[model samples]
Structure formats: C-alpha cells, structure tokens
Target: MGLRRLDIDRAALLTALTARDEGLLGTWLDLRDGTLRALVEPDDEAFEARLESESDHYVKVPLFTREFRLMAEFVEQVDDDELAVRLDQALAGPSAFRAWEGVLAADPSEQRHWRAHRESALEQWAASWLAGIGLTAPWTDEVPAPEVPALLALVMDGPVRRALGSDAEAHTTYVRACRDLCELLREPFPSRRVRSASRFARGPVVIERSGRDVTIRLRADDEAG
Candidate 1:
C-alpha cells in the first residue's frame, strides 16, 4: 500500500501511548479536509474490548532496538548521509536511548546537533520506519477536526469507566470527564495571541484581531482600559 500522510496531534497521541492508555486504540479522526480515518485501529473492537478489561501495565514496544541490527544491514541503502550515520550508531548500540546518552555524555554540543538533525529528519524517519513495520502512518502536524465522540471514547474507558460506575448517574460523571479531556485537547481558533501581565490577572489575556489596522490598548486590572 502507498504511504498516507496522517496528521496526528503528537502530544495527545504520545500521552496515550506513554500512559498505556489503550482506550485510544479504537478512536477515529475526522480530518479537517473532510476525510475520516481511524486514529488508531478503530475497527478492532475485540482488541479494544480486551484492552478495556485488562488491568496490566503498558510497556512501550521496543521497535527500534529490536530491529536495529536488521536495519543496520540496509544502511547503505539509505539516501541521507546524516540519517545513515544515526542508523549506524543506533545499530551498534543496544538501544537508541543508550546511544544518545553516550553521545550526550561524550559531547554536549553533539546532543544539541542530534536534536536538530532528528527533528529535521522526523518525517523521513517515520516514512521509512513505519513502512518497514507495514504501516503507512507518516506523521504530520496539521490540526484535525475535533470529533468529540471518538476522543471521549478514547480518554474515558477502562479506569475512568470503572471509577465513574455503570449506573445512569455515571453519564454525568462521564460527560464531565470527557469535557475536561476535550478542553485539554481543544485547538485555539481564529488566531489569537496571549500576553501575560500582572499577578492580578487570573487567566490568559487573549487578544483577538479585528479589522485591518485595528489596535487596542491594554492596562492592568487596576487601570482603565
């Protein structure tokens, strides 16, 4: 299958993965472009149901370390010189974390350089590594349409479900929890800027744009607007 560019909210997705929040497995994303696709493996009802029932701790799959040697064999096949160097280092070591630790301990400057290098090549790495694992999900930063139902399902399963209880009264608790999650993942709209002023200000000071050349004067709460 051809590679598909999938726009994922990295922070939110990573949160679920790190927390072993298996609730997200069957969620779907309705994209801003009007296309709908499973955010994870949405159709895997059996897998998701099993996940909900299981209470085991989640472990990160060691994809890189396990495949390092095999991937190393194909270093010469890589077109990018810098990534090839990274691939070599990764292959020579037991894990990427250890390899990076050694590099940082040896030369702090090299650590910063590696960060920049990794960020620049993330798309390429995702494309290559995901393909190797038989997945076409290349990461992108584009914001997705907020499909509240699926997102709610993702964040409110397992522990949250049990905690809230299965009674009719639980719907209120579920809605409250889902609303909180949605607020956390909500994207800011209409393009605004926030500036911090005094300690007296209780929340974010948002400034929304108006007509062209429009300007607004701001003062502290003690002062007139």
Candidate 2:
C-alpha cells in the first residue's frame, strides 16, 4: 500500500497535547483529513456510531499527564542562574505555579522565552509521536513510510495461503507470526499494539477534517510557514 501522507489540523492536536485537564470525554483523530473530533457528550450516539462504522479512519488519543514538564525542570533549563533560583524557589510553596507565573509575568522577555521553550518541547514531542505512526511533520526532515504488520500481510494479503505450499512448520510459523501481530496490535501503542499520531504533512499541528480529508497546521510553531 502506498503511504498516504495527510495534512492535519494543528490546533486540535495541540489542544489535546497541551491539555492539563485529564477529564476529557474522549478524542479521536480522523486520518482521512487529520482533523480531531472530541466527544464532549458521552451519550452522543450519532457521533459514536460514526466513529464505530469508520473505525479505520480514526485513532483515539490516549490519556496524557500535565507533568510533561515539571516546574523545576523548566527552571533548570533557564539561562539565568538568579532567575532559575527564583523559579526553583517558587516551586516550594502551596501556590507554586502561581508564584512561578507571577515571576514570569513580571519579566516579559523571560516569559516569552519560557513560552517558546515549552512550545518547542511540545512540538518535538508531538512530532515524535506522529512520526511513530508513520506521519510527518513539516519541520521534521525525512520521515519514512509506516511499517506494515505481519498479520495484515498474512491474513489480508494471503501470505499464509502461500505457506500451505511449504512444510507444516512454515505454516505454523506464519500462524504464530499473525498471532504475535494480533497481540502486538492489541497492546498499548508505543508499547501495546496501538497508539496515536498528531503531526501531518509539512505542518506543525492544527487538525481539521472535510469530507474524507484532513489538514493539520502548526499555528504556534515559529518555524512553521
């Protein structure tokens, strides 16, 4: 199969990626157009049915942690030692994030730096996640096509049928390979047999879908045109 490169929606992916609230209803990426549609109301049967019928085109977004970066981690990356100390100290109290925000708000330049720093990290993270799923980001260079699994080839493409011409051991191997692929796919993505993508085309990460197509843009990426 030819690798289909999609142009995805940037904002929607970023919204999912940068989400601090773990209490989302659910989110899915429509591969046909790279647009993400969130299921806000759990009982929306029409939307649920659409997702079910068109399951191949949609990938579910996993639960994410807001602790992608710790306050101390960001502080350590700061260029200024004094400011770093202040930032680090700010993490000591009850209103740590507020205190840290107070400091950054007082320093416009550093605040900009912090935002840029965080955004850059997020871009990289999102790009890596997408690339793992055989998608490309505009800023990233030379992403190869996705790897097809053994089960798809054996079951769908009739490789196991060909195994019938060979010895019993060969056919058994093929069956085992398909079983492994099934287990792998059932596993959690990255680790399991499933997972997610965000980046698309030569863009940052805005995801929009029209008809059977998706376009993603990176609105916050300074490097994205």
Candidate 3:
C-alpha cells in the first residue's frame, strides 16, 4: 500500500501559529509544513518533545538558523558599534533614533526571546520597540492614525531597514499599516469574497432557471464592449 499524502490547511495553521497566545502544537504543525498530521493532539510533553526535535532538525539543517542568526547578530553588532555613532548622530540632529536614547537600551528578556523565538519575538519587539521609541502610544492604548507616519519612520530607520535591506522599509510599512487599519476597521474575520483579477476572469458564473420559459443572453466580447 502506498503512503497517503498529508493534507493540511497551511494558511489556517499559519494564522493559528501567528496568534499571540498560540499553542505549541499549532506552531509545530506549521513548522512541519503539512508533512505530519497531529494524532494525539497538543500538550506540554508533546510540545516540548516536538520542539526539541524540531530544534535539532533546525540545527542539522543549518539553513533555518543561518540567516536568522546572521540577521540577529548583525543587528546586535550594529547596535553596539553604532551606539556612539547613533548617540552622536542623535545629539547633532533631530533623529528619532537618538530621541529614544533611554529606551534604546536593551532588555535581556526581549533579547533572549529574539534568540529563542525569532519570528514571534521579532514581531512583538517591533511593536514594543515602536512604542518604546515614543512613535505610537502604549500597545494597550488607542493608536492614532497621525502617529503612524512617525512610528513607521522609526521602524524604517531601525530594524525594518536594517534587516530587510534599505529599499523595503516604505513598502513594508505600507503593507503593515494597511493590515493594521483593516483589522481596526473590521471584525477579526468577515464574510467577504475577495476575487483576484485572474480568477475572476476564469472562474465560473451561476445561472438560475425558473419553471417558465427561460431567456438566455450570451454576449460576445465586441458586442459587450
């Protein structure tokens, strides 16, 4: 008998994994990339064992941590090397980097989280760092739309520009701002049909029929136009 191919919802799993209080099983399932299916479900023991195995696999793979650690190290080293430079630059001008001198100081816990849980910590730190920089208000507080530009500018100068290359800051900020605004404007999920242009062109259309004589109309491209 042939082995059945594993089928799982990658998007759903990813969404679940990205949640603030995501469970280990969901994260593990996401890391597995739908190759392994959950049988017994998630618990601390299962989570720890899976996490350990995954961590071991990550170590062996090297690809997983190579770029992540390299970026993290680069940020850490750059922050250190440019500490004086940043201080001087801030002092000389009205740069946001210099403005938050007190907050720029590192927190060991956040650093540790960044090292251990790279993606989650990076996102959390992005928000926290923005808040710390006085760009936006506290995470718990209401964030005004006016604060977005300055907050985005701070992010652009800081990690977004540093880690992802210089050209991406504006684009990243725009995309994130759109997502944030969308969430703020609507419920978590809404029943809305989002159609892609390509799909809309190629997808099917439904036609309803009644018991009476039906009149069908099919128009050609030139006539329609």
Using lDDT as the measure, the top candidate is 2
Q: Name the TM-score of candidate 2.
A: 0.56
lDDT of 2 by residue, 1-225 (tens): 323467776656767764545445677778778888777744678988999898888877643333324456788778888898888788877787788899899889989988887666556555656666667765556553444543444344321223233444543443343334433232212322211232211222233233333333333545542
Model 3 weakest 10-residue run by lDDT: 195-204
**Which portions of model 1 show Cα errors greater than 4 Å?**
1-7, 11-47, 50-100, 125-225
- Candidate 1 lDDT: 0.37
TM-score ranking of the models: 2, 1, 3
Candidate 1 lDDT over 1-225, as tens digits, reads: 644454555433333222323443322233222122222534576644544464242211211211333344455655668766875786566877576456455555555665555444443333343343333443543323323433334434321213323434344333333333323333211111121111111122211222211112222356532
**Reference-based lDDT, residue 6, model 3:** 31
Give candidate 3's root-mean-square deviation (CA, Å): 19.5
Instruction: Predict model 3's lDDT versus the native.
Output: 0.33
Q: After superposition, how far is residue 124 of candidate 3 from its true place, in Å?
A: 19
Q: What is the lDDT of residue 28 in candidate 3?
A: 36
> In order, what is each prediction's RMSD in angstroms?
22.0, 16.4, 19.5
Clashing pairs in 1: none
